[model samples]
Target: MTTRVIAVGGADAAAARLAACLGGTVCPLAQRRFPDGEHYLRVLGAVEGADVVLVAHLHPVDPLLVDIVFLADALRELGARQVGLVVPYLAYMRQDRRFQPGEAVTSVSFARLLSRSVDWLATVDPHLHRHAALSAIYSVPALAVPSAPAIARWIRAEVPDAVVVGPDEESGQWVDEVARLAGCPGITGRKLRHGDRSVEITWPALQPWRGRPAVLVDDIVSSGQTLVTALQGLGAQGLQAAACVVVHGLFEQDAAQRLQAAGASRLVVCNTLPQPGLPLIDVLGDLAEAAARLIAPRQG
Candidate 1:
């Protein structure tokens, strides 16, 4: 079965790598911005009557989402049998629910929108806080492809003597998985949320990590506030680490510099966002491999 690869704007390098690995025809979609600030997307090649896999990663106000929906609808109209969405990093996931009055649960709404538009959905390390199962949250078949194993392999090769540490209790599960793969001990911090919904992070259990090369692991690093707080807390306890490893490196508002100033020796992340000052570990290979396995010819 022949597959056609369509990569929308973000993470072009990673997308290209995945397309090369899949041996699929790469169709580069051009993104243009109107003088009035609107967006334009153009599919460069023929997509009629083909199985199209749309690859893109969501950044702050990502234009890729708009393009994905358009591409999916166009492909279907042009005779596409199936449309597969492979988003390395899913945005608006943090707003999965609305606590206050009159707010949009962008995650669910976005999931529904994408579900109706495509046949299958795949993403990595989505900000799933309270969802018992992601499949239950989406009307379509949703899969969470973790980058922990890949991150672990890279950390093991680079920082051989590092311990995995979760910046907060929320990151415990991922830390455990990464620790297991990296063959290192792991620790999760205790967190206290204030009335303002601000967090007071503490790693009281990090006493044993005082002199070890520790690695802080998490799914997202938005403002770097959490990491800065964690690193300061670690310092207060005289706990020091080797580096930090994050899955989705948003690095908003100079978060990377903030983490460094807070004492992160090194920052390692997958090539999901085109942020500055970090190594781009290609995650598309893992994503494409998983997609290939999942969409493989159904056995009789």
Candidate 2:
């Protein structure tokens, strides 16, 4: 069975490229928003016995979810052999557990909803806190691919004289991995997060690496407070403005602008979600390999 790659929302180009990489065909998805903010979707083409991979980035979570859920069901009804999902940046992963009384563990709940829909799922650098892996919550075969290699390659090629810096101790392992892969020294700081917007971070021993520029690495940036805090600290020490590299650039509202104002010389994110005008580090190779692995069983 040939694999058919289809995109939801604005991922059409990425889907076509992925289809080309897999030596498959591109199946377009028809989507429209009704006056009342409801979703109207149609999966175009004839896939009587073809395997389909639906590519979607769950950034604007709610509405896109409606499209994904409906399209997945339609694929099954239309006689597709199997349906696979590639969610570049998954939403609702921040609250994996309940901290206080009567709170929803959205991460697990979202996982349940998706597990029932798609045959297999994959994402790039999911903010996996508490849960060991995606398989812990998802009933289907779920893969969480790493974007460290891509980030490292970018640093090596673009910023040759750089020392990787993680904003907090929680990110120590991740920072070290990227640093090791980039062939540079890495250091992680300690962070005391008061709330989502308010945070306090202790500087790592950045003085030793003062000669080289700093590259701030983060998995996902929403409010940009942590990175701003890190930047402020770096500025106080008279260090060069850091180059910010993130796996997922979930900069809400004017967060991206705010980050640039906060002394970020360059801001770059993985091609997980499209950020117009900003430079994107490609993770298409990683995504294609992970997606191919998911649909391999059906072809076999």
Candidate 3:
């Protein structure tokens, strides 16, 4: 029996690449939107008695979580023996804890729901803090894939004398990994928030980038607030703006436009999350390799 891979809809190019690497079939699934803005999804491929992998990114799409759950149930009903959930950008992971009294921890709740829906889960650069673990939250076989190699390769190809900047302390780990791979200098700046929801990112003084390019590396870009602020800060120091790289491109409405307006020269993000008209560097090769490693032992 051969393993099968399918994408639930959004961008098909990356999915097709991943399936090609995995020696799997890229089956079809259909989605119909009604007048009321409701989405109807149907899986058109036969997953019965097969090992199935569903590749999707939970970003800029309505009813993604609900749709994945539907597919899980439908696949089970169709006699699929195993299901792997590969969501490049996992949603609701920032809400892993309750911020205040009577607040619901949506991250853990979503994890629990996903755990029950699929047999194994894989995600890239999840916003997991100190209190949470991917496997612990999902209560299943979980894998955390980092985009350091991909981001590093992109930096080497694009930026000149780029200093990898981590906007906040939390991002230092990933920034360090990417910087090491790129053979570039890296720094983690101090960040403080006045309110529970806002932050100020401070950049350090760098002499090598006096007239050179610099890249900002981070896991997620939401609302483009932090990045815009960082770019402004970097420009204040007279450093030439190069590019911005992120794993999850959760750009809010006009976020890309706003960032470009705020003086960011180029924005680069992986196909993990679709960003229309942006410079997309696909990471399907990394993910396909990861899946191959995970399935190797099981297949043996």
Model 3 stretches with alpha carbons more than 4 Å out: 33-41, 194-198, 205-209
Tell how far residue 203 is off in model 1, in angstroms.
Answer: 2.0
For residues 169-214, write the lDDT of model 3, one tens digit per residue: 8889888999999999887778886653366977667665666676
Report the lDDT tens digits of candidate 1 across residue range 1-300: 567787777656666777778777777678888999787777777777666788877775456677788888888887776788888888877776788889998878888888888878778888888766678668866678888888888878987777788878789889999999999888888877663325688665666767777788888888877877787777777667578788899887678898899898888787767756677666777788777765564211
How many backbone clashes does every candidate have? 0, 0, 0
Supply the TM-score for candidate 2.
0.96
Q: Model 1: how far is 211 from its true place, Å?
A: 0.9
Model 2: residue 162 alpha-carbon error in angstroms: 1.3
RMSD of 3: 2.3
Clashing pairs in 1: none
Clashing pairs in 2: none
How well does each candidate superpose onto the true structure, as a TM-score? 0.91, 0.96, 0.91
